[model samples]
Target: MKKILIFFLFFAVLGSGCAQHNAESIYDKDEDRAGTDINRENDGVRRGNGNQDNGMTMTDQNPNLLNTDNQNRHSFSMDVQKAKDVISDAGYEPGSIWINGGEMNVTARLQGLVTRKDREDAQKILQNRLSKALPRYDVKVNIE
Candidate 1:
């Protein structure tokens, strides 16, 4: 019984030591994977500054990062086109459409002679239509 107890204790200590070593190695690997190792100078390899010796940046290494900005611009253009379509459908010539964040500034020209009240009414109607079409944006319409 005593011999068995000693054997079990030895194995327990060995297992604990191995577990600790594995945990430390895992932590080190995680730091390296983050690309910002403080010990980069020791290995003579600088990382995580977006530039590498091969003239490639972090964005270049991951093309998805560039795609994110492109996707945003593409979606914004599509939204602008939709606004233009809405303005045309409302019997106004679509002018400039500016989008800043969640706010949209739209300008449309009214054909034929009109009164101030007519312009105001057209602006309101176009604003309502645009707001309904692009609920994600705060719409402001100018009828000229």
Candidate 2:
């Protein structure tokens, strides 16, 4: 009886995750395209009044658009903050960051006359730190 009660309590807590998720669920349209060309015009046949008694109405957000081929791969991430913290901790500061998909493009600059070796070292450190934190991301570190 004690084992069954514990299992029920665990299940209840796990079920509460849906309510605890605070982030907005936005769909990645680019990642939705899976190589195969889909003609949106011929996606579905709609009857009058937008009511489908025999079928389901198709929107831009189709459940099939999700990556069913590879469940492990995700299109979105929050690695920009990690890269910022990494560079800041290394004593090199980054300007505005522009992120495109999984790629992070950052530019760092130092005032006054600076040696080429100093710039190179800063770039290397940023690349290494970001790569280690986000292995799948393409890090572009530019120092000026």
Candidate 3:
């Protein structure tokens, strides 16, 4: 009998708590008292209305963000040509040159059989020359 009474009391309290949450009834009184016009258009943000000069132009943004694919391709090709010239001037046959962002990878082929020290010296010389020529790029030289 005691357990049945406790169970009935718990359910009664829970049911009252759940029934007290009427969202519409709580918000309706505030909405009625505020009395603000719901149909008004401009609410403080500057949206362009055909003739108003807001003074904010798209050209004010960063130039790097506005760079097109054509500009990037031209820049990359120029860098590759520069790398090829540097490799050729260093007395090696330029095989392939690749430029990615600020890094350049260059491959050059030596004509005859060369010793390991000769290859190492050649790589060092090409690396130094490329670094000096293209100071903006981190260069890697491969001799084959």
lDDT of 2 by residue, 37-142 (tens): 2323245443323444445323223533444454444334345666677778777766766777667787776666789998888789888887887787798988
Model 3 RMSD vs true structure: 9.2
- Give candidate 1 regions above 4 Å deviation: 1-26, 29-74
C-alpha lDDT values of all predictions: 0.82, 0.66, 0.77
lDDT of 3 by residue, 31-135 (tens): 244664333435844343454545533333432344344333335667788888988888899988987677899999998999999999999999999999889
Q: List the residue pairs that clash in candidate 3.
A: none
> Judged by lDDT relative to the true structure, which candidate is superior, 1 or 3?
1
Clash totals for all candidate models = 0, 0, 0
Give per-residue lDDT, candidate 3, residue 15: 93
Which portions of model 3 miss their true places by more than 4 Å? Answer: 1-74
Q: Sort by lDDT, best first: what order?
A: 1, 3, 2
TM-score of every candidate relative to the true structure: 0.53, 0.44, 0.51
Q: List the residue pairs that clash in candidate 2.
A: none
| Model 1, TM vs. native | 0.53
Best by TM-score: 1
Q: Where in model 2 is the C-alpha error above 4 Å?
A: 1-77
